[model samples]
Target: MAKLYVIGIGPGRRENMTLRAINALIKSEVIVGYTPYIEYLEELVEGKEIISTGMKGEIERCKLAIESVREGKNTSIVSTGDAGLYGMAGPILELAKDIEVEIVPGVTAAFSAAGELGSPIMHDFCSISLSDLLTPWSLIEKRIENAAAADFVITIYNPRSKGRKKHIEKAVEIMLKYKSPSTPVGIVKNSGRDGQEQIITTLGNIDYKKIDMLCVLIIGNSMTYIENDHMITPRGYDL
Candidate 1:
C-alpha cells in the first residue's frame, strides 16, 4: 500500500530537519507543500516531482497529496516547524481517511525561538496562534486571558500579518491585565534560518514593528525573568 508522510522541515534549514524527515522525503516520489516550503527543500527534492501552491491553498495541497498516494505513489507533504503545530498535519490527517499516514515531527518555532532567547518555557507553557482566519477573535482572546490567568508561558504564532495588524496589540492588552507590565518577552524572527533575528523586550514596551507573520512571540509568565540579557523562566528548582 502506498504511504503518505506529513513531514515538518523545521524552519526551512537542512541542519534543522530531522533524519527521519529527510529519509521520508528521499523515499517519496512526489513532494507537495506550500510554495515557500517547497522552495526551501529544493536541494533535497531536486529529482522528485514537486507540487506547490500559494498561501491559503492548504486544502488543495492536501487533496493533491491524497490523490498522488491513491495512485500508488509515495508522497510527502512538507510544512515549516512541527507538522502538528499549526502546520499541515491536521488537514492532511483529516483528509486522509483510509490512507496509511505517518507524521514526522520536527522542531517547532516556539522551541527554536526559546533556544535563541533563554529557557523561557522551562515551566508550564501553552502555545496560541494570534491568527483569526479560522478561529474567532473572541475565542482567541478568551484563551489568551485564561492562559495568562493560569500563568502559562505563552508562545504566540502568526502574531501579525499584512491584513491583520491590531490583533497582537489587543492580545498584549489582554495579557497586561493578568501579567506585569515588565513581564519578559522574547521576539524571534526567521528562527533557525539565515538572517535570523531575536530581541528581548517587556510586555508593556514590545516593539511591534519588529514583529511579522514569520516571527514567534514568547510572552513569559510572572516567574520569568531576565538574567544577563537572557530570558529565563524558573521551574521551581532549588538554586
Candidate 2:
C-alpha cells in the first residue's frame, strides 16, 4: 500500500534521530521537508526524489507529499524535533484522504533541551509556542497563565523572533504572576546539535535579548532548583 511517513528528524543530527526514523527515510522514495530540515537529512536522503519548501510553505509541502503518495510512491515528510509537535504530522493527517499515514515520533526539542540542561523537565510539563502566527496572542497568553498557575514545568518553543520580540517578555511577565521570580529557567539553543548553547538562570534574571526562535526555554516548577550549574526538578524523591 502507498504510505506517507511523517518523520521527525530530531535536532537535525543522525545520532539524535531514532532508528525507526532512519529506516522510514530509507524506505521512502520521496523526501519532503522544509529546506533547512532537508539539509539536516544530509546523506541519508541522497539519491531520493526530494521536495523542499521555504518557511510559510507548510501547506504546499503537505499537498506535495500527499500527491506523491497518491502516485504510489512511499514518501516521507520531515520535521525537526518531533513531527507530532507543531510539525508536519498534523497538517499531513488533516489534508490526507484515503491514504495510509504513519507518524514516526522523534525526540522533541523539550527533551533535547532538558538533556542539555540537566533534567529541568523531570516532572510534568507543558509546551507552549510563543509564536502568534497561527494562534491568537490572547489564546497563547491564556495557556501560559494556566500552565504557570498549574505549576507544570513549562518548556517554551519559538520564544522570540524579529517581529515578535516582546512575546517572551510578556510570557515571563504572566508567569511571574504565578511562579516565583527566582524559579530556575534553563535556555538551550541548537539543542543536541552543532553550535549548541545553554544558559541556566532564574525567571527574574533571564536575558530575554539572548533568546531566539532557535532556543528552547525550560522553566522549572516550584520544587525545581539549580545545583552545581545544572537545573534539577526533583520528582518528589526522598533520600
Candidate 3:
C-alpha cells in the first residue's frame, strides 16, 4: 500500500509551506496539483514526476491521485489555502473513501486576509464561495440572503471569476437589502505574499468586476468598523 497525502500549499510564497507538507512532498514518488500550484512549487521537486492538471477537472485529478496511491505509488495532491476548507480535502475524502488518505492542512486565504485586516474573523462569521460550478446558484442565493439576514460577517472565497462576474454583486445586493450600505468590506489580494493589495471599503463601494479567484473579500456585519485604517469586526464576546 502506498501513501496518499492531501496537502494545501497555502497561497504562493514558499516560506508559508509547512515543514510536514514539504517532507511529504519530498517522500512522494509523484506530486499532482493544479498547474499554477505545480509551477509555484516546481523548484522543490526538481526533476521529479508531476502531473499538472488545469484549474477545472479537480475531481478527475483527485481520482487519478487516489489511483496512483492505490496502485502502490506514493502521491501528494496539492490545494491552495487550507485543505479542509474549500480545498482538496473535501473532494479527496469524497472520492477516496475506500482508500487510506492523509490530510495535511495548510493556511487558508480567509485567515491570511483576516490577519492582515486585524481580526475581522475574531467574531462570528460565515464563509461563502460565489462560484456556482458545483453548487447551484439558487442554494447559494438562499445562503447569501440568509447570511445577510442573520447579519453574519461573510468571508467570500472565489468571489468573482471570468464567467461568474455577477455573483459578488448579487451578494452585495442581498447584503445591502438587509444591512447598511456603509458596512465595511475588506478585500485582500495575494494575502501574505509580495504584490499583495489590501483595501477597506464598503458594500456600497465593492466593485465585483475588480475581484478575482486570488482575492478574499471580507464583508463586515453591522457592528464591524474601521479604526486607524484597519478593518475590525468585534468578536461579540465582550472581554
Candidate 4:
C-alpha cells in the first residue's frame, strides 16, 4: 500500500531532524511542502519529485500529496517543527480519508527555541499561535489571557507578521495584567538553523520590532527567572 508520511523537519535544519524523519523522506518518491520548507531540505530531496507551493496553500499541497499517494507514489508532506503543531499534519489528515497516513514527529519550534534560550519550559506550558488568519483574533486574545491567568510558561508562535505588527504588543498588554513586567521572556529567531539569534529580555523590555514570523517568543510564568543569561523555570524540584 502506498503510504503518505507527514514528516516534520524540525526547525528546517538537517541536524535537528530525527533519523526517522530522514528515512521517511528517503522512502518517499515525492516530497510536498511549502516553498521555503522545501528549500530547507533541498539537499535531502535532490532526486525526489518536488511539489512546492507558497504559504496559505496548505489545502492544495495536502491534496497534491494525497493525489500522489493515490497514484501509487510514496509521498511525504514536509513541515517545519512538529507536524501536529501548526504544521501540515492536521490538514493532511483531515483531507485524507480512506488513505493510510503515518505521522513522523520531530522537534517542535518551541523546544528548538527553548534549547537556545535555556530551559524555560520546564513546567506546564501552553502554545498559542497569534496568527488570526484562520482563527479569529478574539479567540486568540482570549487564549492569551487565559494562559496568562493560569501562569503557564507560554510559547507563542506566529507572534508577528507584516500586517499583524501590533499583535504582539496587544498580547503583551494582556499578559501584563497577570504577569509582572519583570517576568523573563526569551526570543529565539531561526531556531536550530543558520544565523540563529537569541535574546533574553524582561516582558517589560521586549523589543517587539526584533521579532518576526520566523521567531518564537517564550513568555515565562511567575516562577521563571533569568540567571547567567539563561531563562530557567523550576519544576518544583527542591534544590
lDDT of 4: 0.94
Q: 158-180, model 3: which lDDT tens digit per residue?
A: 88888987888888888889989
Over the stretch 1-239, how does candidate 2's per-residue lDDT look in tens digits? 88999999898778999999999999999999889898888899999999999998999999999999999999999999999999989989899968999999999999998988897998899999999999999999999999999999999999999999999999999999999999999999999888899999999999988899999999999999999889999999885
- Per-residue lDDT, model 1, residue 55, is 90
Q: lDDT (CA) for every model shown?
A: 0.93, 0.94, 0.86, 0.94
Between 1 and 3, whose lDDT is larger? Answer: 1
In model 3, the worst 10-residue window by lDDT is: 205-214
Better of 3 and 4 by lDDT: 4
- Candidate number that wins on lDDT, 2 or 3: 2
Q: Can you tell me which runs of candidate 4 are displaced by over 4 Å?
A: none
TM-score each candidate.
0.98, 0.98, 0.92, 0.98
Question: Which parts of model 3 are misplaced by more than 4 Å?
Answer: 236-239
Give the local distance difference test score of model 2: 0.94
**Candidate 1 residue spans exceeding 4 A from truth:** none
What is the clash count of model 2? 0
In model 1, residue pairs whose N, Cα or C atoms come closer than 3 Å (at least 3 residues apart or on different chains), thus clashing, are none
* Arranged by lDDT, best first: 2, 4, 1, 3
Score residue 76 of candidate 1 by CA lDDT: 97
lDDT score, candidate 1, position 115: 90
| Per-residue accuracy of model 4 over 78-175 as CA lDDT, tens digit each | 99999988988888878899789999999999999999898999999999999999999999999999999999999999999998999999999999
